[model samples]
Target: MPKEDQNNLLFTLQHDFKTKLFLSYIDIKFKAVLINSSTSWYKLASYTIEEKNSVLSKIHLHLDDFVTIYEEDHEKSYAIIKGIF
Candidate 1:
């Protein structure tokens, strides 16, 4: 897709869940996958995030696509990614 279209999608995703308290951040990861027939498909990208509270936030895009937010606690130290959509 065009850069502008991708940016607009990202912006829309951000706005959809800005009010939620649990979402810490959203990161986009793009990948290209090739099938046996040599056709390629662009994954919609992976959205990952860190949570600040116990509540699980629900994210929805204009297309009605959604991802559930959750927290992962480890003993090492402290870090967070607030949103992933």
Candidate 2:
């Protein structure tokens, strides 16, 4: 295989791993919120908007409720935001 092909493969794998890791992290965090057993939510959202928007965009923001949203192409829901943390 050519060097360029190898670089492309590496980039693809890195992107996949990052997406998976992120989904997993958010899943755990959502469960914690539903169970109302974590302060991490508050700590987690304290970051600046620029630093947080990408990951945050995957979910809906609520002051008194939990909300999970997704792109139109994403049929499955990641999290359901109902109860407050």
In model 1, the runs with Cα more than 4 Å from the true position are 22-85
**On residues 1-85, what C-alpha lDDT tens digit does candidate 2 reach at each position?**
9999998996786666556656887976865422222222231232334344464423335544544567689865556443232
* Candidate 2: residue 33 lDDT (0-100): 22
- What is the lDDT for 13 in model 1? 59
- Clashing residue pairs in all predictions, respectively, total 5, 2
RMSD of model 2 against the true structure? 17.9
Candidate-wise lDDT, in order: 0.44, 0.52
TM-score to true structure, per model: 0.25, 0.34
TM value for model 1: 0.25
> What lDDT is reached at residue 18 by model 2?
58
Candidate 1 global lDDT: 0.44
**In candidate 1, what are the lDDT values of residues 4-43, reduced to their tens digit?**
9997996675555453322332222324422232223242
**Alpha-carbon shift of residue 48 in model 1 (angstroms):** 19
